[model samples]
Target: MANKYQRILLKLSGEALLGEQGHGIDADILDQYAEEIKAVQAEGIEVCVVIGGGNIFRGVKGATAGMDRVQGDYMGMLATMINSMALQDALERKNVHTRLMSAIRMEEIAEPYIRRRAIRHLEKGRVVMFGAGTGNPYFTTDTAASLRAIEIEADVILKGTRVDGIYDSDPEKNKDAVKFDTITGDEVLNKRLNVMDLTAFTLCRDNKTPIIVFNMNIKGNLKKVVCENQSIGSTVVWDQ
Candidate 1:
């Protein structure tokens, strides 16, 4: 089956890597994510990823605890690089070609992020993992994902989360929470659904970039969403 999107940017939370562990990454989760990505890539869909660093460090949390905001944010960025490298290694072990690019250059580990180069890598069937959260203090990885998706002209941004989709209320806590299979960007904002930060959501809203929020922990869910176009998640669009 033809893919629903030719290219996609996957946004993952670093906390997702923790996977039943108290802290740090779980080997099983890494392998599962690598396999899921490989399945979608095998269908000829271009994939790029941006993962958050909350599992290791969260700048906002640090700032509240009296740490210098800028310093904490940079520390958060490095944490993202660590997660990205781990994911890259897992993908490589599965024989999936990948490139680790960083907004903050560390030539010793990852290539400095270049727009054209990232697109070219996708064109050659390589998965590109973007780390360091836009290389700016104050911006979240969600914004980084949106920025990269727009720069690469990705068809959509796939936000992998623990939940199956976006809900009217917290599904984990509200048994009666309602899920919307499709919602407009305007509606998401009006309802104040915490999809992405305002900055990230605005970028997609202005650029007409659609977003899919799905459960990444489920094996084969990514393939079902990207390859088969199965309605496995909630889709946020500029218009319904």
Candidate 2:
């Protein structure tokens, strides 16, 4: 089947890497994500990824614990690099071509982030993993994902989480919470749904980038969404 999106940016949470572990990454989860990504790439969709660092460290949590905000954020960035490297290794083990790029300079490990180079890599069918969260102290990886998606003109942002989709209330807590299969960006903002942070949401809203929130733990769902264009998750758009 032909892909609905030519290019996509996948946003994954660091906590998702925990995969039942107390802390740190789970090798099984890494391999599962790689396999999912490989399936999508095999369908000829250009893919890029941005992962968070909550499993290893979270800047906001550190700041609340009395650590300096800037220092905490930098530490969070490094944590993301660790996850990025792990995912890169998994993808390579599957024989998937990939490039690890970081906002911060670390020539020994990853290539510095270059917009054109990233797009070029995608054009060449290489999966690109963006790390270090924009190299800024205040921004979250969500913001980084939005920024990168816009810069690269990705067709959509796939937010892979444990939840199946966005809900009117917290599904984990509210038994009666309602889920919308498709929603306008304005509706998300008006309802104050906790999708992405405001900065990240605003960037996507202004750029008219669509976001799909889905359960990444589900096997074959990625391919179903990208390749089959099935409504396996909730989709956020500027308009219906």
Query: Which residue segments of model 2 deviate by more than 4 Å?
Result: none
lDDT of 2 at 84: 98
lDDT for each candidate structure: 0.95, 0.97
Clashing pairs in 1: none
- Model 2, 1-240: lDDT tens digits are 568999999999999999999999999999999999999999899999999999999999999999999999999999999999999999999999999999999999999999999999999999999999999999999999999999999999999999999999999999999999999999999999999999999999999999999999999999988999799889998963
Best prediction by lDDT: 2
lDDT of 1 at 215: 99
- As a TM-score, model 2 comes out at 0.99
Q: What is the C-alpha lDDT profile of model 1 across 1-240, one tens digit per residue?
A: 667899999999999999999899999999999999999998899999999988899999999999999999999999999999999999999999999999997999999999999999999999999999999999999999999999999999999999999999999999999999999998899999999999999999999999999999999999999999799989998862
